[model samples]
Target: MSDLGALFYYLGIEVRQGKEALTLDQSTYASKLLEQSSMAECKPCVTPMEERLKLTKASTAAKIDATLYRSIVGGLRYLVHTRPDIAFAVGYVSRFMEDPRENH
Candidate 1:
């Protein structure tokens, strides 16, 4: 596509124009996502997920709503558009959407 000339915004992502290059941000999208998932009060973290931690389908933890879990995971996937760092974590969680437990 030809230069769209400073993509002001698209799909909840804010684009900032600068001399060197353009920057994409998704704070607003993230906030609304958190609020929708009732996690607005959750703390920010450099590492969104634990390292070396393993999730399994045999957990005895209580089961969570499959629909809600899928919705949240889908949002997380969308967030990867700007925050690629969380792609691994999001993908990890997505593995359990079909039968997500609290521990997942």
Candidate 2:
């Protein structure tokens, strides 16, 4: 076995080790996720989700591609590891993966 030195990148996370702290970043992964969802130019929100927004399993909105929806949700789920601030938002979207709609 060989050592790879400091863990700069692993899986989709970028790691930085400083004298006082360790930092984990996922900007590249998040960007790729945005591109995959065809939202590369989406705006950033101070809040990951809208306040008081509610999503339901049943909806009148038209259906969207379930595969792509699931993929994006999965990426967001993974992102929650390094970006725990978005866990609630990711979990909110994950509920509709079975039948994602335009409103999802």
Candidate 3:
């Protein structure tokens, strides 16, 4: 096939091509995810998770909607293709899918 042109976006990831490099990002996907999770207005943080933060199945914590948690995690997993920075955090939270708590 012939070269179509510089790719700008594909599969939820944005593409920016320059003379010496190409950049891929998922800001749109992330924004949509936040909206879907009802966290669109939440404050942004420099790090996905706190340093040395430990998460466990808090039996005493209030229960959350398993479906919502799973859906969010699933979206994050998909986003990993372009945003590996969040892989660890997403994977960590995904571990509690079966019984996610409010603190998860």
Say which candidate scores most in TM-score.
2
> Which regions of candidate 3 deviate over 4 angstroms?
1-3
TM-score of 3: 0.84
The clash count for each model shown is 0, 0, 0
Deviation from native of the Cα of residue 48 in model 3, angstroms:
1.2
> Residue 80's C-alpha lDDT in candidate 3?
92
Query: Could you arrange the candidates by TM-score from highest to lowest?
Result: 2, 1, 3
Candidate 2, pairs of clashing residues = none
For residues 5-102, what per-residue lDDT tens digits would candidate 1 score against the true structure? 75788988899989998899999999988998999999999998888999999899999888988988998899999998999999999899889999
Please give, for residues 1-104, the per-residue lDDT of candidate 2 as tens digits: 99889999999899999999999999999999999988999888899889999888778999988998898899899999998999998888888877899983
Note the Cα lDDT for every prediction shown.
Answer: 0.90, 0.90, 0.90
Candidate 3 or 2, higher TM-score: 2
Per-residue lDDT of candidate 3, residues 10-102 (tens digit): 988899999998998988899999999999999988898888978888667899888998999999999999878889999888889989999
Which parts of model 1 are misplaced by more than 4 Å? 1-6
